[model samples]
Target: MIERFRAGVLAAALTLLLTGCSAVMVPVSPADSSGLGRETVRVGIAYDSAGRGDKSFNDAAAAGIDRAKQELLIEASEAKTQAETDEARAEALRGLAAGGSNPVIAVGFLYATAVGTVAEEFPGTLFAIIDDDSVTADNVVSLLFSEEQGSYLVGVAAALATRKDRVAFVGGVDVALIHKFEAGYVAGVHSVDPGIRVDVRYLTRPPDFGGFSAPAKGKAAAARLIAGGADVVYAAAGGSGSGVFQAVAAGRKAWAIGVDSDQYATADEAVRSRILTSMLKRVDNGVFQEIQAFVKGDRAGGKKRYDLKVDGVGYATSNQQLGPYQSGMEKARYRILSGAVRVPVS
Candidate 1:
């Protein structure tokens, strides 16, 4: 039952979530980008405190691990988060190591401290940390993204789709990571419409929001904006964004833009058709490539940053049904990428 619940969260399904499910992850494959060398590797992934239910960042990371499982012949496991602790991360890594996994990968910057100390303690085990990298061992691989580029594109999408010149942005926590996304989106909005106004708000002021699992707050923040006459909202907040969709659904006239994976499918039937689009960070690609690289003796060393120019991030306008203004979004997306237009990255 616990496994079922975790799967439901990772699937980002608002409904059909079976009660009492535990977290379970099966990593993906390396078969897509050419043939895999003959080796069966096992990998472990850790989630932020929000767990997978928040359905944005953690889910995106899981997707990458899923890709590794499908393409690479490997065993995959997951560590459910209880808090931000090196002990929890180290324990997860230890489990992966015990299974003979050569290189265990940790998702999110929260895993940095865990990866840093654990990597040193287990010098034989290779490690990969996504989003933020450490100054530790040569055995670790860091995966970062060019979020500014994607944010710029999505910012344009928000500006184009916004009914009022007033748009808004909501983030999980007001940390540097969220700030990066905020900065990029703000730049994008300003580039298209200088006078465009965006009310920036974070679920928590700083350092924390333990219930990163709360979608209610997302709805509340979005509702305030909707009431304030803002017609478009971009939320980089995780599980809380489930509420953003609810707020968008209520507003009817407004639309919610999603992040990480395409969020169109993540919404309810009534509002899903209304989602402007999603800004994608191909984290799954990063995780999958890391596995392939390790297997083929080509793992990237030091800090690796993925950007729009490198195809690491982009916008997904394609969906079950393209939204009301798909073409405009596409044009803006290309313009930003090709340098024909510049979106602010903050």
Candidate 2:
């Protein structure tokens, strides 16, 4: 019987490897056995291609989970996709749900289809997806953000900081979601100076998400932009934004704006001086709120829109270089929150 059990365990481990579902379960604390009646909720996160140390989007989501573990005392499991295939994502989700995670969070909109399929398979489990709102399911909640609003504020900063009256926007992927960043940035720059030239570039088109993870491509794109007289460049690329910062640091009198998180705070000391500011998307807040809602027994799944009104999006003012431009960014922020400025998503 012991040999049979060992064989079964080996087979199960092989199955997990074969499916590429690398879910690592981490218990925050031992189960409450004192009869205090405190139940520890289990949470799962399926990260994007860049995973935890991307220092941007995925890291923001990880922050929320970390907060939950400390405050809510929840057990957590995290999985990253080995490949950018739909099947790999689905397998990761399946592995988490089957392992008894109550709420499995898919960290990116790219997981929309996978979440939809897996949520159906595990009807009792609650699932939350960030960025994409197309998945309508009883077990799934969509955490949407107004990225354009934040991008617009950073755009204002870029416009005010640029000495050459020429700015650029670098996108990781040519998708609708990223287009929102470009649209808001261009609008903000033009709002300050109507004739200011804006150079836009995308590292990769759809289905080729290498743009988000490829730092070399990001560096090349930003270097070209700086060489072409763009004094301030805004990077809406995920992990690739690091390359943009590096390029800006290497350039003479060039500045770069980051996206999703306060890149200046996490950036290397050499590049921090060059990062003018970052468009804060607040993915961490969104992730934490969803998990909190689930734990509170408010499991009704629907779309929750996070906008400037709720402080869900804004510009980071970590770098003291932004002190001179804070007034302009604040003015833009007031306009957006007051409904006076209708930031474009396209």
Candidate 3:
């Protein structure tokens, strides 16, 4: 089941400008009123450009915070990046940290530089950054994932499901992080059938993060791939995956794959049938566990890697269309976990 929850939005009057962006405080669940004396810790999340409604990467992170709000004695607030500039990201982090939010969480790799710069200024504050490990600090915890390992499993599914013996990968941005998805997918496709052709396209290049949020661009990219004979399409784009699904559905015979969250569960009923499977990147689990550690006074900071062996990343089999490929995907999963298959990150 895909757990969906929306954070109560504060009124515009409550919006506070920390630097140039607004940090809206989300109304969190009440603390435990029992005699256990539960102290509420304030948690802040700095979201990427797409924010909460992206239903992909940002939503996965929000799901984690929602889980924390329900299960832990905590208050939460979130600030989103308005501009692609590093200064804007730093300001979001600054605003959250300045407002007394401990263990401020940066939701995407885009915040790596901002987190490192802001962490130095707020030495007492604990910051956790997702999808990034470049920030090395006593107060920073890097939450990294084995994206290629999970992508490889989905690639295997795409390879097995393709009718034209041609598959395609749609990425939101042409960055090093997204390259891992493309590499694993290509590797997985070739593993199943060395003769099958795999095509890759990115919506936008670096510094222009709009690619993650542009559905039109995603649709156009997928449409082109489908026109070129791709029978199965995998999109690692953020919100843009929705467009890819639409294009795949219109293609009628093509299958679409989702990333980060189970797009099969979240997709529209019209397009849900076309989704073969999704690459599940458990960002929610990572965020919830980080919060749990913070609540227990275990704020030790370092790099924590979530991989196939730990069930941190895998393929979602929510759709019935994925049934035929389950055994093959499982075999691929085992191979990855057993170190027999070394997925490429480039």
What Cα-based lDDT does every candidate model obtain?
Answer: 0.75, 0.89, 0.89
Cα shift from native, residue 36, model 1 (Å): 13
Residue 228 in candidate 3, Cα distance off native in Å: 0.4
> In candidate 2, which residue pairs clash?
none
Ranking of all candidate structures by their TM-score, best first: 2, 3, 1
Considering every candidate listed, which one attains the maximal TM-score? 2
Per model, how many backbone clashes are there?
A: 25, 0, 0
How many clashing pairs does model 3 include?
Answer: 0
Model 3: lDDT to the true structure: 0.89
Better of 2 and 3 by TM-score: 2
Q: What digit string (tens of lDDT, one per residue) describes model 2 on residues 1-346?
A: 9999999999977865664333322222346343222345789999987899999999999999999887777779999888898899999999999998879999998999999999999998989999998999998999999999998888888889899999999999999999999999998998899889999999999788889999999999999999999999999999999999999999959999999999999999989999989999999999888888776666778999999988899888888979999998899888887889899999
Off by over 4 Å in 1: 1-39, 319-328, 339-344
lDDT of 2: 0.89
* Candidate 1 lDDT, 104-183, residue by residue in tens: 87878777887887777777778888888654577788999888788877787788777679999988777777788898
Lowest-scoring 10 consecutive residues by lDDT in candidate 3?
16-25
Error of 2 at 123 (Å): 0.5
RMSD of 1: 11.9
